[model samples]
Target: MGTLGVLGLELVQMDTPPTTAYLQIYTEERCKANCLFCAQAKDSRAGLTHIARGMYIPADLDAVVSRLKMAYEKGYLRRACIQTALYDKWWEDTVYLIKSIREKSDIPVSLSVFPLGDERYEELCRLGVNEIVIPLDACTPGLFDKIKGKSAGGPYAWERHLDGIKRAARFFESVGTHLIIGLGETDEDAVKIIDELHGYNVNTALFSYTYVPGAQLVLETNKEESIRHYRTVQMARYLILEGIVAYLDMRFTDGALCDFGAQRDVILRLIEDGTAFQTSGCPECNRPMANETFSMMYNFPRKLNDKEIASVKKELGLG
Candidate 1:
């Protein structure tokens, strides 16, 4: 795992090591929620150590805290991201980890967890969590219910998650949520929800859905279609966030993004550097290869090269 490599717990090679130390709270029990796509879902048979493409082997808490301090100082990492899964001891584990990290380091911490109460949010803010992410994971309530909400046998509710994100906005300066693409949502659906959240000051991180072996749900998303959809949505997100175009101004035909509704030059100029296609989320969180393969890099960790820029243009129908 990239975090393990940074902590000197393992020898692994990454073309670009994650700028953020991606650590998941270690636990033997499966996550209580049954998000169908997750490897740690309640009824999942997949390895508990796997999250998307990252294999997070458990390590010593004190050692990781020590290395994290070193990594932050040496500029190997700019942030610490702690991922949480629902289980009986999640709160205790999360608190302990945050406290431990705070004890040794002042590096900004990002906590990616599901919806929690204000009491928990206030405590996390007090513990120096710079950002809090409550992942909606789906673009619409129908899709959310089918996969990560109650219909999927999960405890998450769309309304409750939105409330929690809004609640976090009041407590944390940077509030974010995750929305995984390629999960049966239209481009318009993705853009609309993103804009809606943006109206509330919630930043959305985009992820392409991956099929992990032994996971509960097996989906066969069309590769080219998903890529086109993701590229369009990525650029559109940049446009909306930057005020180049509002979601309402965008044209959609049968749920596909037809026109960006911005001047072609404006769009072209923005995409020239390819920050539009980089990983999105809390500041300094470049999740390199977290949901991508070498052949199909959805989110480039660094700046895009000329060839990649050309390819991205073609993918987004810019050229």
Candidate 2:
């Protein structure tokens, strides 16, 4: 629905509009896979239009595609990101949407989906999808099994997801994945997976596990703990990706990151820049409030003010 407003398809107001046009395929059928955290999961009782606080209402495809062309040309949006749900004809709808956008404009396109075959990956590349994201969602295999794999009655397997990312990397220049924090993952666990995915040339985007009323999964957690874990992984990920430190160089105690191994001045410099805190994903994609509330923001959609930066430092125990 936010994308609708940005495209002028819906009357809405947003303090920080999304830079990428987030389009989800419309279908009454729920996903075949039963991922517990997903509102669109087969067994989930949550509304189908809900995806972590973002309401994606059904809209006319041609209308959205046409407006998307105008929005891109005017620079209100940078990329067209197509999110998919696992249902019959998903591939067909996804292909049609991508082709529709490509025929109208030269805008950069991104596709976020589950694992696919080599032919499909190549097809996505041909369709002008510059970036492909296959979300792992969990920090480790055990957590994955519990949340979205066989244990949760979902079709996804951790090894296959990792394998899918590797396969997709061959077809697309930019391959990325997602990891949801506060799903009972330790700081060290999050950073370690980021390091591993880095070896595969994959960029890992971070999300805080959000609780929706009708979704099956539930956990008791505090805000302070959640932010602390996110901040640590974010900083550690930056240091590792920047080549300032490696996961092996970092110190961990009881599965928590005890030290980042980078010097105080280097860490301070990164914090001041604030790129480490923004939404980490496809280029030019800043998901404003995608996984946050007004009082707490996991990913600052834009540059950080001095006060927010100070809050970040405090979250990392540096303030």
User: Candidate 2: lDDT of 84?
Assistant: 90
| Cα-based lDDT at residue 232, candidate 1 | 95
Stretch of 10 with least lDDT, candidate 1: 1-10
Write model 2 residue lDDT over 154-237, tens digit each, in one string.
999999999999999899999999898889988888999999999988999988899887999988889898899899999998
Alpha-carbon RMSD of each model: 0.9, 0.8
Q: List the candidate 1 regions with Cα displacement exceeding 4 Å.
A: none
What is the lDDT for 184 in model 2? Answer: 92
Name the runs in model 2 displaced over 4 angstroms.
none
* lDDT for model 1: 0.91
lDDT for each candidate structure: 0.91, 0.91
Worst 10 residues of 2 by lDDT: 237-246
> Model 2: number of clashes?
0
